[model samples]
Target chain A: MSRPAPRVVEFFSGPDDLSDQQREILRKMGERFPELTVDELPLDSDKARERGIPLAPGLVIDGVILGVGSVVSAGRIRRYLQPQQE
Target chain B: MTEAPKRIYLDHAATTPALPEVVDAMLPFLREEFANPSSIHAAGRAARQAVNLARSQVAGALGCPPEQIVFTSGGTESNVLALLGAAFAREESGGKGHIVTSAIEHPAVLGACRFLESRGHRVTHVRPNAQVCIEADAIIEAFAADTFLVSLMLVNNEVGTIQPVAEVARAARERGILTHCDGVQAVGKMPVNVESLGVDLLSFTGHKFGGPKGTGALFVREGTELRPIAAGGKQERGLRGGTENVAGIAGFGKACELAARDLEGNIDKVTRLRHRLIKLLDTASPGRLNGDPEQTVPHVANVCLVYVDALLLMLNLSQRGICISVGSACASGKLEPSYVLRAAGMSDFASFTSVRFSIGPSNTEDEVDEVVEQAAEMSALLRKVRTPEEIGQCDENCPCLWEERVA
Candidate 1:
């Protein structure tokens, strides 16, 4: 059986404020992990508030708050998305 | 007590609070001494005396003759007057002259040059080298036989890099080119002698040095003919024809006097505080100091955090009651990267991540300590949310990855 896809969520204070470098990071992450699903979460949204994300640039992976206030690299996303060994 | 919610300001480069002495000196001008300096009455004489005294005070601070100073609305007007006035004079003398200026100059100077260009004048914008200083050679290389004026800044407003104005001035002088310096950031924050700089014209504003806004001065050396930009009453020796900003000029004079008197001590204190803040920031987070650390002014510190957007960081700091800046106040409200940093050879991303912290004489050690603690805590907290590898191989765009990039 194939493993389930990793979930990736990028948080931003606003939609228009996304930087080109940040968009590049997300695109590269998608290329690395084919099963990875990326989502942009705006800080002003109710969903972001409910998740208790910091009011800055943030990234969450599979329900875990991985980063805030910076754009994450593809290599780091791969490391975070790797399957745990039992 | 909850410590009064800590309202520390690190944006002295934007504008300083008027000093008590400045305010006291200006009060008489605003109240009983209020009169048009041009009027022939006793009140006018008193006002003229105040303006003359202020002129002398400013001249004493700048090490120029009082007669050479022309009071104007502010730095912007002073810069425009110097650039436009000289360019027009050159044009009248049978030359549609070229002007050479730096990319890192304030908008006022740049705008004046742009306006000149729109009027059939040519302009050469010299870019800074990797070291962030506009090398004297660059200015010399940009100068053509037709170049009539060279306008460079004393201290850069964004990165705080000090240019070799004296060397550039000397080079321009040898070539018979007029020289103008926007000394807004350098006048009170550092040692500024118009004579020693050997420039034909220098401009400085009041608010940057704890004086009122709307007051500024331009130093026009003797024998440097300039056409007046504004046609009005023969005020400011017919160079800048307008009713003087009496209170603002009085305050500006007092501010200059105080700044000249205590400049060395103030520089020392602000330097120590600036270094302390930088050190604390380095320990708190992984980042790089922008600009030539040694060559830049002691009061302004620019730092580029690896993956952090400077605007976001500034907002975070503001939330904590700390005042900081991503760039110059003039460039505020725009998402574009700093043109000054770009001109200084900084990458676009690096420029986007940079923040400037400017110190002032009024800033205390305790405030510095608070700023450090807050800045460090915020930086560390922001970094912790992401993995160390998340920043990944920072290119030239990443100041965090390069040590030698700081010119």
Candidate 2:
């Protein structure tokens, strides 16, 4: 059986201005969850507005807000998505 | 599956990406204008003219006469030449051989002073007050009968604290001590008038202001005599020796010109963004700013988180796509906490938690907002793993002894 694809929504107002390490981690995250669907949210996107996104370049996973800031690795996103599991 | 986009760069103080305009201006000199400025040939004259034009441009940006400028390899060389040359010259003239500098100076100035100490010169380092501002009167009080030079930076790199160069210069002048202002971090970020600063020598770097690296200039007031540290050629009016870096100098000139024209607008925009970042960080993260907020240059902000480790924070932030600095970029590779923080009376823990976010002209409000959001997330994540108790127990004597064991 195959794992269900993770629905990933990334809100970035700017392009790749992040560090090299950060870009690498994001790439690794994509590799880890091959079926993950990434969506770019505009600064004024309705989803971002309804979810009360405080800033741009924020992340949301499975309808839960991942908080504002730069996301470095897939693990960091996973941690936010599944905070209950250590 | 799609990949997440890369992180953003917010650490302009550490260094800057070379501006495309500067690169374009430098290309011709690098390829075609590669001739010795000293040679009397046509190519040499071209190089000479380029060097002279750059000197005038730098001088103009600083509001000084062109003849007062002397180009050097970079800020380090300019600083060393200023401190060592001035002190040694005074010594040779049978005047006071003592020098006074700030406790929070960059290593370039501090290290030179240390070297002078070994050579039998007296040196005094004046500490800053609670606000991280060096008191001119305190420096004045520290002066000795033999004090010949006083070196202070216009802006503190780590904390972004602006010193009173004019007041300090006036104080130093009253006592006949020649003053040298390290304007490397000040010149392009603010309006710098050497005549108003009243300093005998001022050092500035090109890379800090969107120019090519390895190109810097020192402003020497007329009639202030100093012997050359490097002796060989008659380059730089016999003060510095070596064939001129024509391309680098030309780029430096263009960078200065651009900086002068855009100084105010750039400051206003970056300052607003910096304030927004500070406010966001203050609200989201458990930290406080490290220096006097109003007394600093607009582009730099130093935030100190109470319980978080700065290196860990930097690592975490880097993981998130935000590029910033832990402290002075030049001093970051060293495992030690910042000497500047220690001098400012920050505790070892506070010093360890301090990170410098130096903005530049190219940064925008949106980017600053993103940085704030990401930084808050990272801070929250780090705080969870390291409890306050665990953080308190962290010290040089901790049994974990990871750093020592590795060493």
Candidate 3:
């Protein structure tokens, strides 16, 4: 069976806001889930406000904010997406 | 199976690796001689003696009395103490005193001024001239009848442009206004004599000069009084009140001794390297070199590259084992353009494209050449990939005007 379409997006003002560890985690996620779509949102963009995402780093899975303002590990992301994955 | 790449550190402005001599000086205090300097026991006496010796060493470098050196956590605390302390003392004398400072001051000094303003103190922020120098005349013009203090940095943290602190101090002295100099970037990189600068107060940090972090000092001239901002113990002669970082202070003293000994040699070597790097950048690509190259210190080179993102450039440099920083490290990770570069007359777009490469004694000529080559390669690649709309021309008066004309 084919995998479901990728539905994870991260909204960040800039790469500087992401710590080294967080960037590494995202790299691993890209390797593990090639379908992941990373989106760049300007801090003052209307889409970010419409989505209710913060100006800082905010991770969304399936259009829901899974983590905000902190580095969320890949392991935790996998767990959060378990239902969808299964 | 590949070996790790050898890193070339060009970010001495951020922080430096502790010198071996500094580590050796601090080890004893951290291990065998660990004791509270404030205590009355033998071990305490030994610690106190070490602290006293360090004080004298710093005083020797700064050309001030040992008693005038008040140790604080680092540059931030020292600057806060100087601004708030002087302002409070002025208010106590029955006047709502004002402060005059440059827009290019490090956030430590600028933030303190902001705090003071929040508490009702008036402040005037002077702008730098086209050369990125905070002209003494501009500072003097900003002075008000109630202006009690003028805080200016000796060396701008981003551009390394050395201010005319001595001239400004002379101008302020005639008006009976106190002067404070943030010498965090200048003290070790250049020859700094507090007496020669003629400022009423001066701040210096340890890590900037090869000493351990968490160690710094403020030189309060004799008869210059400041109300204690961190009041508790009678430490630092009741001006700064906390048990000092004995090990850090010891390392600071050793660092100062080393800096003073190597001052001339370091300046000569770094100046040559800075010129070579600037030349390389100019020849390799088209970019605006920020700040007055002649007026700035020999250690720093800020460049603004059109069509290149500063963040991407920094990351590419980091991946290539080259380490540098964007603007002040304290203000790094913020999306806002550097206030320092902005105040120096760069538009927001130009400020966002700028990167700072601060050289140190540890950097070699070969490394300088390597960085230049890599920067050129990266700039070309980024420019090719960026869309036309993303690339914009700089203001007409950019420092690279001559280079543009030549190109």
Candidate 4:
């Protein structure tokens, strides 16, 4: 069976408050992972709160918390998304 | 796969890293030269000489006599002292009750004006042009028989727009209104001669250039009567009362000296790098440059990318190892959009989508190129997710819903 395309959702305090650095990182991740679908998770959404995501800007991959920090690079996010060998 | 390096730092306008020379100049004061400048002993005399020398250097840098320079804790304090001192002096002299300032001024001036307004002083905030430059005529028009002070910034911190301070000063002088300039961003970056500008008061901070933080100065032209804000020991000629920040002042003086020597060369270098970065971004992205390109400072560039979410873009850039800021660093921590941009007629979406890239001497052409490439890529990615409807609703067209979405 083919591997499913990685689904990633990035949560932010607000849509307009992204720093230039953060925006650049998201762009790189998009290029490196062509099959990955990136979505913006609203901070006030019940779904984001249920997942125990921190109040800071963060990213989640395939329903798993990936990273919680300002300006998370694509390489670091990919590490979290990579499938581990059994 | 190896991790990508952290994003490059391009936000020098917010605050610059202290230069190695400034650090070296401050080490002795921080460690061994721990004497009170006012003490009568040899150690005290030595400290006093250092302070005096630093003062003279700063004065020289500003093309004013050393006696005119009054050291303050930072730009905020300097701004307060300049505005309040002049306003109070005018009031004491039975002058007018009105104060005039530009809408594009740093919060330091605006806050001071607000405080004055609370105390029954009327303040008229002059709006800037679409290019973010404040007109001298607007300031003149705002002035009245009761107008005693006009506060304007030499260079706007957000958009890097240079104000017509000389003309404004000349106009204010004609009407006997004291003019104060917040030169925090302009000093050390450009040639600032108080005599030429003809302003009675000016404020500058060290960290904005390369000196230590918490150190700044205000130039009160000789014979300009002013009231003291801080009451204590007669430090800073009794205007500001506190133990002098000897080390920081020494470092600031050194920074000013170096800035004077390197101002032209640094401007040329940073301007070239900024142009190169802007050119690259223009070629690869649907980004519009904010502010007047011709009249802006060399080291700052404000760019607004359409369709891309500012927050997402910032996160992605951080992930890519490039460090840039959205709007002013002072306003970064706040969830609200930039007031400066809004005042300049930028829509909520443009203000939200805009990011400021302030370059410094430490930045390189290579870093600028890397940033531009990453920014272009990130903008493209964010744009992919934003539909045309979303883009249309980004600015003022859908303010009510947009606030709901953000809130």
Candidate 5:
């Protein structure tokens, strides 16, 4: 059977809305992982809080917080997934 | 990944990009000319000469003698040294010391005043009027019988209002009170002559005017005795100690020379840009200008946009490669609303949302237009989604709620 699509959750703080740059970063990551399943998580969400995410505009994959702030590079996101893939 | 966009920096009040000429002047000192300025060797003499020349350049820029200028790390150190040194110098002469200053002073001066108060010195902070300006008579009125020093800033860093330092300094001089002016924002941006300002001590830094960081100086009038802040060899005429920042000093001197070259022309150019920005921002957003337009320096324009969250706006602007500063600063790891605005009688909401846009000589009109356009468009979008607290319905905008949210 085919491997299940990797799940990527992008978090924003304060409000439910995502900024243009945040959406663009998410889009870039989706391009690399064609079958990527994206989820929006507000920083105040129980999942984000329980994981001890330091800040918003964060990326959570495989139940681990990877990064925060204005991240745009898909290559960096791919590298971030390396440990999780291993 | 695509290359980053060209950044449009509009925060000269915080710091300016060091000029290419200044960088060239500093590099030799940083590399081959590195030497302890105090050593008796030939190399030391060369460094000492460079430091002397730098002092003269700074002195020339301020229309003072080179001997009066004492180099320090930056504006903060210069301010603290001036305030504490003046306070202690008076106490050493068997007189209890007191200082009269304004409420909107930078934290450096405020911190120094608090330190003096802890050491048994008195400090009276005079509140500014609705125009965000301290009246000369008001400052003089606050002076106590034992008041030995009056410290005031030449310009309010956040609001850009030029203070009546010369008039107050003159009045204080007549009363035998020494005056120190925080000229960090005024010295290079405009004409700042110590004689004209009538200040016994004036603090200024290089980074505010196209020079390297970690370099600043304080002007102590001739025969004004100041107790040393540090214990070391007889550097800075025993007022400040330790080895001089040779490279930074060199860059600072070059910047001063260049800044003074065509002061009036530079002022006119920046003034035109400030007007253009104000007009554009006024049309695009419903907000009030925070400073006295007539009395302020033309570089910094602080505006308070109604219903828009400034931190959110700043994040959006940063994504577009436009750099601006907020009127409020991050204090103790959490950003706080402007105490400066509160002291100037602004409402809590206005203070929380005001943004400071400081223009430099290098900034072009097109750049100003682009930045303001982006700012206004983003702010409008942010206002729609902002919480009730951000729009002044609650106590204050909890900055941590969106502090880490960039873009």
Candidate 6:
């Protein structure tokens, strides 16, 4: 049996100013757990508000708020996903 | 197990650790000497003498006569009494009067202006220039025939930019307008002579200069009459009436004497720390200083770390055993961007990203190095989530400037 990939969502407060960075973060993450899924959304969307996002540049991994108001580094995210890959 | 990081205090502008000498001076008043200064008994007389001696010590520091000093609770109360007491007395004599003040003043002054407005008196709040220094000429220009008072800070608390106090006082004096200087930040740090500054009233507090908290005073120039703000027995010359904080006042007096002693070579020491922080912050954030670099005091360095939220940075630094603040620690529990930066005409991004790193006389070069190294690390990690080079430039209409977004 195969395990499900942890859903990753990155939310930015205003405009999607960090789209390029998210792409870079995703590409780096893909190198490790290629099956991991990532979603980029504007915090203005109802989806982010439904999750009770506290600050901009928020990260939600598998419905758990990993961090807000800062970027949880890509290397750390890779390490976070490695166990799920196993 | 790892060792806990050594704590480094970089928020002296907020409050300093009370000096041991000051604490020792206050111990006697706090304990055995429980008599009120106003009482006529023997212990009371001793208390009165202590209060009088503190007043003289404070007066000697400010270069004013002892009778001119009216001790109050702290800086905020001193400022409130100065603004309201003077304005009300003037208004009672001649119909309601108007006031001219800067927009970037501490909440104490701004809140008092609101109170003055509620009582039907008008006030014009002038904004600072790009450098965050309130212009004396601009304040003078805003003065109307009905403007009877101009309340300006000697040193802006957030940015530590010394205002054009003497020049503005001279100009206001020419027009017979009373000038009130909020000298809270300048009194113990620098040479503060009320006569030389040419201001009719000035405010100072002890905690800001390493004394006990809840101790402050106002310098009311002779012949400058102010109606009493607090109604009580004729303590503080009937201006601010309440049983005095005997211990705190004694500590404040000691703090003043110590400040005067330290003033000889203190600026050079504090300035060295400030310059070191500013110079090294360049490699950390590559952002500019928030206020006028040349016109600022030696004790503060309000640096902007672009795209980094100041609140988040402050939290990270706190966890690392490094204490810093965004703007006024008075507004703690509220995580809004630096309004002083906004008032100084910076972008919301700049305002939100700037952290005030205020050094004190006791801070060392090693501490500055550690702070900059920590700041560089945190800011680098915080900025990783942003794509500033591509899509970070924002305008007023930019959605990124939105104060409210996620529910």
Query: What 10-residue stretch in candidate 3 chain B is worst by lDDT?
Result: B327-336
Interface RMSD of each: 7.7, 11.2, 13.3, 9.5, 11.6, 7.9
Task: Tell me the tens digit of each residue's lDDT in model 4 across B71-127.
Answer: 998999999999888777777778549999988888889999998998889999998
In candidate 5, the residue pairs with backbone N, CA or C atoms under 3 Å apart (3 or more residues apart, or in different chains) clash, namely none
Model 3 segments more than 4 A misplaced: A1-86, B328-334, B395-407
lDDT of 6 by residue, B241-326 (tens): 88988989999999999999888688889988888888887765566677787887789888767666566577667757889988
Candidate 4: tens digits of C-alpha lDDT, residues A9-69: 5544445445345566777767876666767666567765655443446566554444443
DockQ of each candidate, alpha-carbon based: 0.07, 0.03, 0.04, 0.08, 0.06, 0.08
Local accuracy of candidate 5 as per-residue lDDT tens digits, B1-407: 86767899998899999999999999999899999999889999999999999999999999999999999999999999998888778888957778999999999999999999999988899988766888999999998888899999999998999999999988898899999999999988988999988889999999998889999999999988688788686899888888999999999999999999968888999999999999999888777778677899989999877767665566557656888877765554345678888777766677767788999889998999899888887776555444444256323432222222221
lDDT of 2 by residue, B1-407 (tens): 74644768888786777778889888988788778878899999988898888888898899999999999999999999998888778778875478889999989999999999988888899988756789888888988888888999999988899998899899888888899999999989998999889999999899997999999999999999788889887878888988888899999998998899889999899888888999888787767777787899998988877566566566556656678887623232134667787776655566666798999988878888888887787677666544555445335432122223213
Off by more than 4 A, model 2: A1-86, B1-7, B328-334, B393-407
**Cα shift from native, residue A36, model 2 (Å):** 23
Deviation (Å) of B29 in candidate 4: 0.6
The clash count of every prediction, one per candidate, is 2, 12, 0, 32, 0, 0
Off by over 4 Å in 1: A1-86, B1-4, B328-334, B384-400, B403-407
Local distance difference test, candidate 6: 0.80
lDDT of each: 0.80, 0.78, 0.81, 0.80, 0.81, 0.80
TM-score of each: 0.81, 0.79, 0.82, 0.83, 0.82, 0.82
TM-score of chain B of each: 0.93, 0.93, 0.95, 0.93, 0.94, 0.93
- Candidates 3 and 5: which is better by DockQ? 5
When candidate 5 is compared with the true two-chain complex, its DockQ is 0.06
lDDT of 2 at B397: 30
